[model samples]
Target: MKKQIENRSDLQLLVRTFYAKIRADQEIGFFFNETITDWEEHLEKLTDFWDMNVFGTKNYHGNPIIAHNAVDKQFDQQITSNIFGIWLNHWFATIDELFEGENAEILKRRAQKMSTFLFMNIFESRGKV
Candidate 1:
């Protein structure tokens, strides 16, 4: 029986770890640099997003497509793909590091599904596939 993560603090740590990886990665760091005006607020919003998604907290209501579309409008497909890939990679890595049992598996599956959806959206938007 693995311990269940039942609070926002655990989720915040996961988000922070994911962003640390994003900041360190050369290929995707520029996206963070260009898009995030206030890093702390961005992290908080992201933590809230995950809290809502993973914990059903109902704390996040931001439009993800609009935000990503804005960034996609600025950057090309390759950059977007790199960003998404690194984003999912770091996201799942953080989850795996900090969680266990069904919770970890759930996060991993959700991240993979989101990555696939983002890739398909990118491809469809570009009329590539």
Candidate 2:
């Protein structure tokens, strides 16, 4: 019996579950596993981010664009759409495994949009286009 993502606890579950796959994935795990030193703190921040994203709260203030750009530079711009694709795949799989209903669907759509937007920005930040 899955449920809607109606609260912070749910978002926490979603973020934690989704990131587990990301951290374990062979193709993209190194990007996160190496960069994020504090899993507990990072998970809390990500929970806050999803809370603000889904619930219109203001608990999250970190700039994803800057963060991602720095990651790209740190890895010599190795980040690619295939990596984002893997990320999205994990996100969608995690959501489907945990919950259902409008919030579940909304998270999928949001992830899709964010991946595209982030990749574009990452590409532009590389100064290649």
Candidate 3:
């Protein structure tokens, strides 16, 4: 039986596993390939982010929208809705593999909301407003 994400370790595992897939993906990998020189630090930040998201821990503080906007500028706003779909697919698959419970479900739902919010900011930046 899969366990519900109940602590920081689980969040770390999920963040790491999810990013490993992202780093290997041919399409969305480039967004992170060159920019994130410190993979360990990046993973730590992501762990904190997910930890806060899933567990309501207050350890993460960063403007994700600003960060993704920079990424969009780097690739000329190529992070389309389809790319976000791929990201969410990987996230759901990772969560399903390691977790099964209300918190796990919350993780996916929060990710969906986050993706939409971030993408909307990106679209606005591209004059799609």
Candidate 4:
């Protein structure tokens, strides 16, 4: 396990790589293309998101649930699942590749919990459970 705090570069790299994968993925790309026009703004927002979540920088202010709800209104469940799955996969893979330590394990667990919470909320919002 590697120290998570020392892997801020890995965090930024992972985020950028994940978004790159998303942009290229056919299933999820359409949603991104449709919803986002300014790449710089998205990247900044994502940086803030990661900073707050992983670094305790407390920079992210946007509501993920609100964003997901908007996406859900426009896209179907399959697309949403595909996006989330790929995002999680890339994120975890990046962490595994760049860091290994107790902090990394904690980060992974936190990410999983967040993912589960988001997915559960989406399902509940849709009255699917």
Candidate 5:
């Protein structure tokens, strides 16, 4: 059996793996590929975000809705549920591949909720486009 995610290091690894899959994906890779000039910094920020969610750490403080809204405008594409679904798929797949336990289960649930919330925010902002 795979080890459960148990620390910041595991969170970092998970985020890195998810991003690696996303950066190569055909459906939504353009947004990340064109926007992220610094993969290391972005990955660090994502690690912090996941840490905050998974471990109750307060290291992340950015507004995901605003950031994604800006990216949507920059790319002239609406962020849709399909895109979020792709992202969630990669996220859960990474978690399942790496770990299995309470933390992994919680991460999948949290990611699903987060994706829904983000998609709602993104979908609501579609009127501006």
Candidate 6:
């Protein structure tokens, strides 16, 4: 039986497992695989991000908007909504596979919102340059 995401450890599992799918996905895999060279470090930072997001942990300090904006620029602003959709699908699927509870649902909702926010910011950033 699956369980709720209640701690940083659980977030670590979700981040690691979810990103594994992202790294393997054919359509959007290159976006990550090409940019993220340090799997261990990236996953740990993501775990902390999700931990802070889902549990109010104060350890995560990275700025996702800036990071994603940089990636979009790195790719010459080729990122599209399709990429974000695939990313969200993997995230939702991974959470469903490993967890079931309010926190899981919250994480899904938050990811969806964050994706939109990040995409919009990325789109907006393109206009500035």
lDDT of each: 0.76, 0.93, 0.91, 0.73, 0.89, 0.92
Q: lDDT (0-100) at residue 83 of candidate 6?
A: 92
Question: Each model's number of backbone clashes?
Answer: 0, 0, 0, 4, 0, 0
Tens-digit lDDT string for candidate 5 (47-113): 9998988889998989998998788778766577888899999998999899999999999998899
Question: What CA RMSD would candidate 2 show?
Answer: 0.7
TM-score of each: 0.84, 0.97, 0.96, 0.77, 0.94, 0.96
**Residue 94 Cα positional deviation in candidate 4, in Å, after optimal superposition:** 2.4
lDDT of 3 by residue, 1-129 (tens): 999889998888999999999999998888889789999999999998988887788878988999999998988767899999999999999999999999999999999999999999999988857
Model 6 TM-score relative to the real fold: 0.96
Task: Report the error of model 4 at residue 103, Å.
Answer: 4.1
Highest TM-score: give the candidate number. Answer: 2
User: lDDT order of candidates, best first?
Assistant: 2, 6, 3, 5, 1, 4
The superposed Cα distance between candidate 1 and the true structure at residue 67, in angstroms, equals 1.5
Model number with the top lDDT: 2
Q: How many backbone clashes does candidate 6 have?
A: 0
- Choose 2 or 5, whichever is better by TM-score: 2
Worst 10 residues of 2 by lDDT: 48-57
Q: Which stretches of candidate 3 lie over 4 Å from their true place?
A: none
lDDT of 6 by residue, 7-126 (tens): 888888999899989999999999899999999999998888888888787888989999999999999998898899999999999999999999999999999999999999999999
Q: Can you give the lDDT of residue 64 in candidate 1?
A: 70
Give lDDT tens digits, candidate 4, residues 41-87.
89878877776776788778999887886677777665355567876
